[model samples]
Target: MLPISYSSLNNSRVNRDGSSRYRRFIPEYFRRIFHYPQMDIEYTFWIMFYLCFNPSRVYKITYWHKQTKNQWARDDPAFVAICVFFMAIASMSYAIAFHYLSFFHIIKTIFWAVCVDFISLGLVVATVGWWVTNKFLRVSAHNHSVDQNVEWLYAFDIHCNSFFPLFIILYVIQFFLLPILLSSSFLSTFLSNSLYFIAFVYYYYITFLGYNALPFLQHTVAFLYPIILIFTFYVLGVVLNINFTISIMRFYFGQ
Candidate 1:
């Protein structure tokens, strides 16, 4: 049975397709989080989505989620879809605003950018998960017979849920803030970098909560470990940017 908040959304009417007649988005999302908070993966996802739009409340969400005793490993597909949609919107905005790129070129650029961004972020997540599991997570004495591979997967799941807000904000800056400030070189770079730094610091705090929440992994000094991973992602992004620039030069200018 659904909770009162969820079940009452459509006045208790089932739709023709066997779905709820009413689609309660933000309200039910908030309701679930307020009621269940920690044990509900759906609540966690709803909280992530809320933070994506209202970034200032990230700290509160992180604190609340940390109090729950339940563990979650599944990825949120809805958040991914929202992010990809934003990426497409950003790409379309760039294409229309720039006007020099053809439709084919714009499509190609969007595809490549989205692929690289998603894959690079995934790599960072996987790397952090592996590192955390290897270095911090201890094996349960009760599960000594379990294979070692499961530990890393669990870490990945935790990382994904914890870092999702940061992921969404990064894209928001790239796709939304980048275009608006593209006209001014110095101002754009300064503002965008400032926003990114602020977002990263905030995200680091949230991740610290996740670290504390996990039963198998808890350390005071290692709280700053996420910053190192963030720097690694920055270095990877810089290298990719350099390679992309060289490829563009070679293709266009025959250099």
Candidate 2:
């Protein structure tokens, strides 16, 4: 016998013949948690957006079907278009959400934060990872699809004569662009640094459920070192035209 999960319940069920079954999650709980009207819209937007942009890597078989009709699986132009759209949304959301947070900081309620942690963080990490990993791993579709720790190609198909991966450039933008975008003074920079450290320590503490070395390293990178690197890269690399992103892309995609 298997233990039943409250999360999985059937309003209609048949035991022996398997006539029919109803599937549902605790809607009341979801409603209660996402009670805010704005959040309801945000949630719907992100979820729908996620469904569209999200890569379905394990559906190689689906690609088999799609291949007969057309090839939109691996390097699908639609997928790229969706990526661009979602990237724009993500960037816009980041800007708006951060701007809101920077000013008000009123939405940091416990329930909301928990929702952000579990829903947003987990989904993004898992889904993104899965999508990237599927390109190589041939892993099951059930695995984390979003945050497979796979490097994305900024310009995978946009190489000059020969396409090369350029995700490092994208990453650099995410990593460092926040600062310049804000036009921060020294004090604001200090506060941002402080928040970074706080977040790092908090992430470590939560990750291990109390203790571990990896968390310490994670904290350092997330908080202190990352800022230093971003700052340095923005100033030195940009000024010197080092363009590590381009070089890295060349090496990665062999262009």
* lDDT tens readout by residue for model 2, 99-119: 433423333322233344333
Listed per candidate, the RMSD to the true structure in angstroms reads 10.8, 18.9
Clashes of each: 0, 15
Q: Highest TM-score: which candidate?
A: 1
Q: What local lDDT does model 2 show for residue 248?
A: 34
Task: Name the Cα RMSD for model 2.
Answer: 18.9
lDDT of 1 by residue, 109-225 (tens): 577546655445655765775686556564454555532322343444444444556555554445465444443354544554445555676666655654554445446346567
Query: Which regions in candidate 1 have their CA more than 4 angstroms from the true location?
Result: 1-45, 50-71, 139-164, 167-170, 173-180, 183-189, 220-223, 226-255
- Model 1's C-alpha root-mean-square deviation from the true structure amounts to 10.8
CA error at residue 231 for candidate 2, angstroms: 13
